[model samples]
Target: MGTRRPNALQWVWYTFGGKLPAHLSEWVLHDVTCRTWVLRHFLRALTQLAPFCVVVLLLPGPLHIRLSSIVLGLLVGLFYSASAMVETNEHRLIKHGYPPGIGRETRAIYRDLRRTARDEARRRRGWE
Candidate 1:
């Protein structure tokens, strides 16, 4: 829905800006491949918008937080959530490589990471 293929520089910027490491580029790539950009946007928007809505609804004062704030919050939250989700999913994928049950996958990925740093190291060395 937005841009595609965020470079490493972009990732660094996002990370520095407090993102949890969700790679929008990779999510976009996967979504585009699956022809699910609309769904991806919708979900990401909903996730991001949820918090803003809560803030707006729960505001103790009159609903005068500025339309700009609301809109900006929505946009920023969406991007942040999308990025976070991408990062979390990538971590899972790196650890588990796609299997059933997220809990199982998460544990597997964690266990693998603990035991397989050498493998990753070897791969990195090969590229050097």
Candidate 2:
């Protein structure tokens, strides 16, 4: 049988960040594959946040004046958190052929991991 691929968390770290929490990584591996876990979580977060955003936007002037900064800050934090999580997951998905984007550093990481995976596969197949 073919050797198992590196887990999603490994791919995530190799592609973007340094490392992930062991529990979190295991969850990412077990529940998420091919980036579906992250995309699903992202959509879920958006669905939850959208109503709060709409309410904040549609609030009356008095309420807006009283709560605008607070609401905005909270929403901003939520968006940041949501985007980071999505990005972490996206990095994991790079193994499936997603482009790394236009940055030099990111492109280098993507290239390294892709090369490593390719080399390993070739080695296993006795094509090296």
lDDT of each: 0.53, 0.53
Error of 1 at 71 (Å): 1.6
The digit string of per-residue lDDT tens for model 1 on 26-112 reads 442344233343465446457546666777767676566655567777778766766765454444344423433543444456568
Off by over 4 Å in 1: 1-33, 81-89, 99-128
Give one digit per residue, the lDDT tens place, for model 2 in 1-128.
12344465664444343444444443434333432545655554555466566776676677657377657756785678576764555554453344554223443565688899999998999964
Mark the 10 consecutive residues where model 1 has the least summed lDDT.
12-21
| Model 2's TM-score against the true structure | 0.31
* Candidate achieving the largest TM-score: 1
Residue 76, candidate 1: C-alpha displacement in angstroms: 1.5
